[model samples]
Target chain A: GAGVSQSPRYKVAKRGQDVALRCDPISGHVSLFWYQQALGQGPEFLTYFQNEAQLDKSGLPSDRFFAERPEGSVSTLKIQRTQQEDSAVYLCASSLGASAGGNIQYFGAGTRLSVL
Target chain B: AQTVTQSQPEMSVQEAETVTLSCTYDTSESDYYLFWYKQPPSRQMILVIRQEAYKQQNATENRFSVNFQKAAKSFSLKISDSQLGDAAMYFCAYWGGANSKLTFGKGITLSVRP
Candidate 1:
């Protein structure tokens, strides 16, 4: 793909329902990142991945938030028991590995999740 | 922990005019990277420009240029001959080398009046 792609551009989930957002990064990008953005705030880092390894999950707000990059090419962010506060835009970004300096990150359009 | 700050919540500039957006950061690290990203109505994050803290010379991309002052830990973006399309939410971000997360400011909403 020419750029990072995210599925379900818009989603509405009832409170307590689970939602899964997917990301397809540019082919061969070794590093992947997930961020959460509220209505008027900047994107906040949630997790990071290097290949198939989930190196950083420190930013996840609570135990309900989970992310995985199984094959290192595609990733998924699953939210369990979604709450009204969970409504936000989920962004996915990819970058070259450390050897490339990881200076630039390409981002997806993001999935807008609405929890009622 | 590093933090980026953008004081202006909203700014307005007329088309063809020049406008400057201010940003300040606090970090103990000597070396790092600064970036400016634009998010329009479509909500896709786009890289506008980047500056390496180790370099004295500022970065310029077409009409976008930055005035980076390492001593003050300030990185400001100057848009020359602004266009209507330039209207968007602009963010200032920071990253410290590899394995580091990018910290972003709250963002400034830029409005270009024709």
Candidate 2:
């Protein structure tokens, strides 16, 4: 693909429902990141992956949030028992560099999730 | 941890005029990166410009330039010859070397009046 692609550009979930967001990064990107953006706020880091290894998951807000990139090219973010606070835009980005130091991330259009 | 702050919640600039957006960051690490991202109504995040913390010189991309004051922990963006299309939400971001996670500031909404 020419750019990072995300599925279900918009999703509306009732509170306590489980939802999954998918991200298809640019071909061969080594680093993948997940972020959450609340209304009128900047994106907040959620997790990071290098290849198939999950290097950081410190930013995940709670146990309900889980992300995985098993093969390293495609990733999924699953939220269990979604709360109203979970209503936000979930963004996915990928970069060629393994580390963040010199990497320029390419972002997807993001999936706007609304938890009623 | 690095924290980026953009104090201006909203700013307006006339067409052909220049507007400066303010940003300040707090970081103890000597080596890192600063970035400016623009998100239009379409909600696509676009990279505007970037500056390396180790470099003394600023960064420029077309009509976008950054005034990076390493000492003051400030990285402000200046948009020259602004156009109506430049209207968007601008964010300042910080990336610590060796980490993929980026810390971003509360964005500033830019309005370009024609």
Candidate 3:
């Protein structure tokens, strides 16, 4: 599929363990986004990257959470010392990178992480 | 900060019937966009419909439409002749041109009964 692709559709991690989630945006897409969706709640923004530069990351919950799009095409969301509160579905989306904020985002199936 | 509110957490409707989901938002910007996204069991967020605040005419796509009231800051989605495939979680989102972040509501779960 030409859509955004995320690795490890599901991940189970133990407390204090470190985990990394990867996302591959559509080819040529300039904008990538990350979101966190918990049970019964809407997705909250995590971070955004434009090409190789991370433009926005204020949505990240804490310092323990880190995201990087070093090469611009693939992004990784890493968590250090996972906790039960960190368990949620992480979604990745991409856009054509047109005008600033008007482009529609295409989403991936998302990675569901369960922390115990 | 922009905030979207979805009062109804869950709703049920018979297949082939019409259902309306309500959403309200708070924003100070004049030019913005309202969107409704559907998330199925697959966890894929699909864009259903969108409305520009500057436009008076509502936006519609096949069986889905939106009733956007700019003055009241309300944007509701109407699904006509709802089908089983429409059963999913719908989220209302607000996007301002000045802000790159999308503000989303809690979302509503829709169930279709045959």
Candidate 4:
């Protein structure tokens, strides 16, 4: 892909329903990250992956929120029993590596999840 | 704990004019990174510029540049000759090596008047 790609640009889920959002990072990108952006707010980090290794999950808001990158190239963020407060944009970003210039992250268009 | 703050919620600038957005951060780490990212209505975050903590010189890319005050923990973005295409939500972010996650401020909506 020319840039990071996310599936289901928009999602509408009923409360208590589980939702899965997908992210496909750029080819050869060694770092991937997931973030949550509330309405009219900047993004907050949720989790990070260095290849298939989940280096950091400290940012995940709750136990209901989970993310995995089994192959290092693609990732999924799943939220169990969605609540109204879960409504927000889910963003994914990827970088070439964790080195000097790799700090620059390329973001996807993001998935706007609306829990009703 | 590290935090980034963007006190201003919105800013407007005349086309072809220049505009500077304000940002302040708090951190104890000596080695860190600062970034400015732009998110248009399309919702894709694009990196405008970045500055390393160790660098004494400001970072600039074309019309976009940053005024980094390491001592005050301030990093602001200046867009010269602003264009209507520049209209978007601009965010200030901080990254510490130990944290490994980007901390972002409440973004500022920038409108370029044509």
What DockQ score does model 3 reach against the true complex? Answer: 0.72
Task: Give the TM-score (vs. native) of candidate 3.
Answer: 0.97
lDDT of 3 by residue, A1-116 (tens): 48999989999999999999999999989888999999889999998888988888989999999999898789999999999999999999988884254689889999999999
Kindly report which residue stretches of model 2 are placed more than 4 angstroms away from their true locations once superposed: none
Worst 10 residues of 1 chain A by lDDT: A95-104
**Is model 4 an incorrect, acceptable, medium or high docking prediction?**
medium
Q: Mind giving the per-residue lDDT tens digits that candidate 2 earns over A1-116? A: 89999989999999999999999999999999999999999999999999989999999999999999999899999999999999999999999988665889989999999999
Least accurate 10 contiguous residues by lDDT in model 1 chain B: B94-103
| lDDT (C-alpha) at residue B4 in model 1 | 95
Taking the tens digit of each residue's C-alpha lDDT, what string does model 1 give over A11-60? 99999999999999999888999999999899999999888899899999
- What would the TM-scores of all predictions be? 0.97, 0.98, 0.97, 0.97
For candidate 1, the per-residue lDDT at A84 reads 98
| Candidate 4: tens digits of C-alpha lDDT, residues B1-90 | 899999999999999999999999999888899999999999999999999999999999999999999999999999999999999999
For candidate 3, lDDT tens digit of each residue in B7-60? 999999999999999999999999998899999999999999989888999999
Cα lDDT tens digits, model 4, A35-55, are 999999999999999999999
Where in model 1 is the C-alpha error above 4 Å?
A99-102, B97-99
For residue A5, give model 2's deviation from the true position in Å: 0.7
Native-referenced Cα lDDT, model 3: 0.92
* Residue B105 miss distance in model 2 (angstroms): 0.3
Task: Point out where model 4 deviates above 4 Å.
Answer: A99-102
